[model samples]
Target: MKRHTAREKAFQLLFQMDLNEFDPNEELHEHHGEEEIDSFLETLVQGVVQQQTTIDENISYHLENWSIRRIASVEKTILRIATYEILYMEDIPTNVSINEAVELASKYGDEKSGKFVNGVLSKIIA
Candidate 1:
């Protein structure tokens, strides 16, 4: 899978996991059906899950006035995904992560989500 497609799928899987309390394995199976899971997709989902606490902490610190819990689920999920890539995936450029996250936000979240994601990620990257 292309990185873009993998990232989007990872966001969907993680979003379901966060909102519906679905198990990762179940979501993965459900999402891919009989197809082999993309390695990057699996990596993104697992990496976000494994490093969630630290990622949340990083986001919380970078947030201006809003608490991490106060952010909408979509925005929070996008933030976590981008933050995970920024912090852990040395091969992907930080700007690429941030830009992709903003795209995800614009597609799946409210109109303000893109800017909100970009702002928080900018702070995190700094």
Candidate 2:
């Protein structure tokens, strides 16, 4: 799968996991059906899960007045995914991650979410 597609799927899986508190394996199986799971997708979901504390800390540090918990769900998910890529996935460029995160936010979040994501990620990158 393309990285874009993988990222979106990872975001969806993460969102579901947060809402249902289900095991990642079960969430993947339930949402994905028989489709072949992309390795990149697996890496993203697992990476975010594995490094969530650090990622959330980074987010918290960068957020102006917003706690990580106070952010909207979709925006938080996008931020976590991008933050994982920025901090852990060395193969992806920082700009690419930020840009994709903004796109995801614009698509899935409120009107201001893209700007909010960009601001937080830019802070993290800086």
lDDT of each: 0.93, 0.91
| RMSD (Å) per prediction | 0.9, 1.0
Please write out the lDDT profile of model 1 over residues 1-126, one tens digit for every residue.
Answer: 899999999998888888888678778878789999998999999899999999999999999889998999999999999999999999999999999999999999989999999999999988
Across 1-126, the per-residue lDDT of candidate 2 in tens digits comes to 899999999999999877778788777767778987789999999899989999999999998978888898899999999999999989899999999999999999889999999999999999
Candidate 2 residue 65 C-alpha distance from true site, Å: 1.3
lDDT accuracy of residue 82 in candidate 2? 97
Best by lDDT: 1
Clashing pairs in 1: none
Q: After superposition, how far is residue 71 of candidate 2 from its true place, in Å?
A: 0.4
The TM-score that candidate 1 achieves is 0.96
What is the clash tally of candidate 1? 0
Q: Model 2, clash count? A: 0
